[model samples]
Target chain A: MSYRIEELLITTLAPMLEGLEHVAVGAASPIPGAAALLARHRGGGRPRVSMLASRRHASFTDGARELFDCAAQGRIDAFFLGGGQIDGSANINLVGIDGYPASRVRFPGSFGSAFMYFVVPRVILFSLEHSRRVMVPRVDFVSAPGTSPSNVYRPGGPYALVTSRCVFRFDRDRGRFALASVHPGQTLEDIREQTGFDFDVPARIEQTPAPGAQDLVLIRGPVGKDISETYPDFARRVLELDAATA
Target chain B: MTNLETLVEAIHDGASVALAPDYSGCAMAAVRALVRRGARDLRLIAVPQAGFQADMLIGAGCVGSVEAAAITLGEYGFAPRFTDAVKNGRITLRDSTCPAIHAGLQAAEKGVPFMPLRGILGSDLLTHRDDWKVIENPFSPDDAIVALPAIRPDVALFHAASADRHGNVWIGVRRELMLMAHAAHRTLVTVETVVDDDLLADEARAAGTIPALYVSAIAEVREGAWPIGLAGRYPADAAHLAEYARLARTAAGFERYLDEHVRGRASAA
Candidate 1:
């Protein structure tokens, strides 16, 4: 039941978006786009989803949360984003050169990192490229979350961290990152070996479930229309990868 | 020694402010500062803060209504409050996307009559708003035209990575702080430093960065952009921000938080 990175990202979002009344995505962010589109148009009576392009205002479905006004600042049930440089506390730095704008690296847009972190109830972080350099123990720059001086969101912060191989959540009480679950065909041993720092892993971690027929159908079917906005160019650039038929 | 109180007092009611496009360092801090001074009832001529500041203003009860920054339709996986206002028929607002609102405000701050813009058509966002005026397309008959009025606030607040006591600001990357200063009737600045007047009174720094002339009062607030980065000055306060993210779940919670953290407190630490 091992899924590729793309599959892991899209599929994880399908179920994770289950009970949300509404959600808001950030700008120049891809995973958020996929999540919003899937949640909005997934099931017949699914919940409302909103995708906020960092550049423009927000667009919603039915009565989903708005990004242009107070709704963007409203209580967002959940939030997901990739990390360029993440720390122990789950702070993100998408706009800086090694934590200082004066350094060698710079992300032109911060969009709403601080604002989103200011308002959202649940925060989920995703790092597409899981490497020691990218996924560091301490982030060089803190673009959004002021979770920790080093790493450790004050509390009830950075609910989860979704990497390609495994998923982790912050134990609010203990104030540390812990293993929440794993993707199908992945093990803590494998994920830990890949990770650079020492992390807390739950004893009874389960492999992430496989994408069911509904997930695939949703990913391939009506989901595209809802998402026609995010990848207007990319979606057209590449065709849907047909599941390999053995 | 200008704490949050003096900063807020500077912004009198019924004043004009030139709002920046994003949450710049000093402006962001000044906003919390201004809100503390009972400067509620803000009329946003443009959409700034990428919804972060917008949401803050709304939650703070500062924003009575808005005419800029269209609620990103079908964005962020949820409907926008701007849209909900239209849906539930609660809040009073007009639709204008973030950039348009910023651009219009900038054009106005510069004392320009009007400016040209794109991307609002075909969405019904700006279809029928009394604030926005639809005029004949001077360029062509085939395509009609819409004119965005200038948005000028009572007082403009700006932040810089490095600034002198006289208010010579250095905007690291974007050149928006200048626009906001020019747009507003009065401008306030909070910087990382209040350097010697000799360093601040330089004419060379006036090109991209705002000049001392445009700035009224300048305060040196270290790590002004705590939760957000201030370009070259310092990184965001990641730990503090994450705690805030957890607290920003509901308006009631945020309001309570503002009462305790922002309103209740005299200044932002």
Candidate 2:
């Protein structure tokens, strides 16, 4: 069965959420949001998925602070983060480029990444754009560090980084990212050329597996229907599911 | 009955105002009124994050500075006016993380000087915010955490579904509004309707109601959170927002948007 990149991304990310008690997807994250929904659907609703801005999915009654409070209390098992610039050490910069305050370029400032990256046990780093511009040797500003010092009271850190081209697993102890697998049709040289930072590659590199036929059915059917409430444009464009029809 | 203008007039220039994110309740009508009145040099305290409301305020040139975790039009893409203002040195940006902002307001709510939170030790947000301090955890030796100062805005402004004649505002599940009402010196609200029934008289509604004590004033403005709608009451006007996102990309376009939707409508009203 033919699959879109969105389908591939959802299938690839859904398994990472396996056995997680609760997975939260932040704002403007359509792909991860769909993946979480898929994971929940597959798990028979085992992992409670919380997608911010969606009333149906989110169970936070104590308002915006509840998510943070829940994370701080170590209730959230997995979360997703993205960056304007990400370094080899997994330091993600959601703040702007250049100096402090007066930035030459300003991406939207860090939302909950600073706190969530530390509190959530598994933080899957995601950025669709995988070029030197985004994957920098060093981030201009550290919105959230990939890893913290021993005494920082941090239980969570970077787990893996999923990009358009490949996936890289973060070694928290070493403070570096090692290539996990390349997406189908993307070569090792392509990833190496595009990446700004250096990473370790195992002797045998594997291709990222494609979504199964059943995975595509779930994604196009119920998962697409669920995500449309919050991210309509993404569902319509990618899954070809209209809000009315879905 | 209080008028929208009168409620907005209380907000003087240079006043620090607290605003909720788009997903929560937002007073877009009052924001347009502020722009209509040419309010200036305002300091915006976004509870944690902001979107269309903040962008519109910044684009209207009402804001002098913004302190928040983020200001972006989710799904619609980057908040154009905010991005332009930051890059062109039009406004001072005090960057913060989500929990820190919440913590700061929580400190204000508790009448405390500061509140300590975990994480953000290595983030550059620490370097910029002079008020934020990092100290050793007293109880746990050698452990470090960041302390954020209290965020007490002069006024907390938002739109809600309904208000009682007695000034109690029914916010439903958006309890951050209650927090803002508690933390701010004055809480100004614009509601869709002012019901004759006493909100506090009922047990179910009372749970979500912000009492008159915390609410300084309220005016009824139906569909007050237009373009960015109130949850359960209405879904966001995505087409309008997409149009806004498109037009707000350029300075001329933004001004045109202001003229057509904001400035022109204020005069018509």
Candidate 3:
């Protein structure tokens, strides 16, 4: 009857990956990794998952350049990006906080996020923390802008933003997020209170679907084992796969 | 001469130096040696990104600027010194995306003034960079793209699993080192061992070899990438890195770490 937030997030994201040929998961993403694996399992391995950190998932032998090159050549269909701060416009900031150049707080500088965001067709933006501190009115810096100008030759942009509180599908033409559904335990008021940015709230919000028994079985068994090498701590802690397998 | 001192001496103050990405084949031995030698105010370039070497250099106040994609300790968590220095505005942070860094070096590798890159048009990374230009494709004329100037560092430094007497280094799958070597003005390498025979003579090993012509100097330093592993040669010293992460939280703690592990010791290993 009950499911973990990770499982819920995975299930929420799985549909976005419906017919994607190749999905690439970036650094520090255990949930997205699980979701990608789950999507693959559900698709009978249709959408190939390439995790930058995983030996099992990554097919590239050349190095980081190859990953970038692959994305450039339009090989990667879906990708995941996270940020220190993500805003209403779908702009994600992975750079430091407070200001430009000099900031009071600093995160690891933007890795391949900017380049990947522009190329990957289905860019699912997810952050585990959804407080106002994170979901600001505007990020101090934009590591990857959610949308691009019409003449910019852009092929990919933000599809949706999945947070701990709710799911907001990004309307590219409007350049704003529309609240689609709230997680089961969370309320619209909770999302409103926690989120710093403004969004278009639908007349009725749907409940984010909970993972079924079969989803949990796949998550706990094969998917958990697949991501273990890349995310040993996450697999052990979240899924409790270590004890289950042991 | 292919000695440790010579390799360190080649990297002068304010020199734009490029290094390989973390966990591949980090030249930790050279990094420690540079610290021990009091190399200062160097503009460090992490080819795509960096970790221990960049953090340690920043903590030592040896770095003047950092141009990279990201600088984190991966599974180990935040890179403290780099984070602290950036917050304090101690170092000039030229934040970049991963492919851009690679593309920039690639331009240098081809001896080009600049290279065209797809993506980054809408990203703030483009807005902040004066050096990066947005232009219509000359041939296509209809397509808009971003062009990055060449990032030709003054020196390229990395460690490898092995090198022969002839000075060819075997890097296997870590081709970024080769890119760094080709892009920079000079290449410095430290290897785990010096083989008796030439690496290029063996067809299998030769494909992975960066020829001696590209290598300015080579030093055989055992466990060169100590805290960071040398690919297949050894595993990372996790306890030592954990100790580093623990101690490098503050300036004083970092200095204490430097004294014990860096300056006080005869060598890092």
Candidate 4:
């Protein structure tokens, strides 16, 4: 079935959430929020999805700190983090380029990644802008490391990275990412050329599967409606659903 | 009841102020008043993250430093003035993570010297923050954890849905205000309306109410969180925020915004 890139991304991300107890999405993330909702919709509502800043969808009553507090207690099974720059080793920099205090370019400071990346068992690094600038050789600053030392009391680390171009599953043990699959119409060479960091590639590369009819129906209908409440512009532009009319 | 200006006057120059996040209760009216009064050298502490309030304060040159996990305008995009300030070295940016900020405030709330938190052992934030320390868990050998010094602000400022004659403020589910009030030496509040009925009279309302003992002052400013909105009370004025995000991209445009909206101008409502 022909699908928009957003639908393709939602489908790609949904499976990762299967069997997870609770998945939490942070502010300004629509795709992962939609995907988590899709996963919940498909899983007969097994995994609870918490989309921050949404009055209708949020499960937390204790306020903003509750999210980090819950994650610390191992209540949140998965989370999504984006960065201004991400490297192959899975070090994500949400701070800025150059050095600290005197950074030439400043992206938003690390919201919860420094803590969330270590506590949440599965941290999915998602950034739609897949290019050399965003996927850097080395992040200017390490907002959160992809892996911690063996002795560190860390139960969570980088799980996989989903970009517009392809999927890279992070091996925490090896401290490296291996190419999982390229999205439709993308090549291995395209990913290699665009990506600043190096990664492992499988002998038989696979094309990321498109959203099936059922997936599209869920994405276009209920999931779109649910996400629209929090991210109206994204839903209207990407999902093409006018929240008022829908 | 004290007027809005009086409440703003309580926040003197160079005061260390704590503010709630964009999604939580934001005292935007007080923020504008602070800009109008040209309050200087203020240290802003964002409880995890911030938005327009921080940007406007920085843009107006009222801020000396900012300690925040992140500062962004949410769907509206990056907080322009905050970005400008950090890039130009106009303000000291003390980068922090969400839980660490919360932990600091929690420590102050509990009258403790510091609180221990997991993670942040390897991140560069530890390098920048001289205040945070790492210590071995005395109970468990060789297990290290980060300890954050208590954050005690001079004032915790925010707007709430309503307040009673007794000065108790009702914030509904936005409980971070409680933490801010507990951690700060003083709390200044603006409310949508001062209800004649006691908010603490009802058990349900009292559960969500910040008692008058914690509140130092209160003012009734209708739609005090204009453009930012209060949870369950009103939706954010997205068009206004979008326009702000657009105009604040440049320094001159930001001044124009302040002149039109903040200085000597009537409330947007």
Per-candidate TM vs. native? 0.50, 0.98, 0.96, 0.98
Please report, as a residue range, the 10-residue window in candidate 4 chain A with the lowest summed lDDT. A53-62
lDDT of 1 by residue, A21-63 (tens): 7666665456556666666666554556555542222443211
TM-score of chain B of each: 0.78, 0.98, 0.97, 0.98
lDDT comparison, 2 vs 3, better candidate: 2
State which candidate has the highest DockQ.
Answer: 4
lDDT of 2 by residue, A54-171 (tens): 8788789888999999999999999999999999999999989987676788888899999999999999999999999999999999999998878888999999999999999999
Q: lDDT per residue, candidate 3, B78-177, as tens digits?
A: 8999998888889998889999999999999999999999988777788878899988998986798889999999999999988888888889878888
- Indicate whether candidate 1 or candidate 3 has the larger DockQ: 3
Residue A205 CA error for candidate 1 (Å)? 39
Model 4: per-residue Cα lDDT over A10-80, one tens digit each: 99999999999999998888899999999999999969999895767789988789999999999999999
TM-score between model 4 and native: 0.98
Ranking by DockQ: 4, 2, 3, 1
Screening candidate 2 with a backbone cut-off below 3 angstroms (N, C-alpha, C), the clashing residue pairs are none
lDDT of 1 by residue, B3-121 (tens): 54576578766454445443344356666776666566666544353334444555565665555432221122112333333333344554444555555665776788776543233
Each model's lDDT comes to 0.55, 0.92, 0.87, 0.92
lDDT of 2 by residue, B27-49 (tens): 99999899999999999999898
Residue clash pairs of candidate 3:
none
Task: Tell me the deviation in Å of residue A49 in model 4.
Answer: 0.8
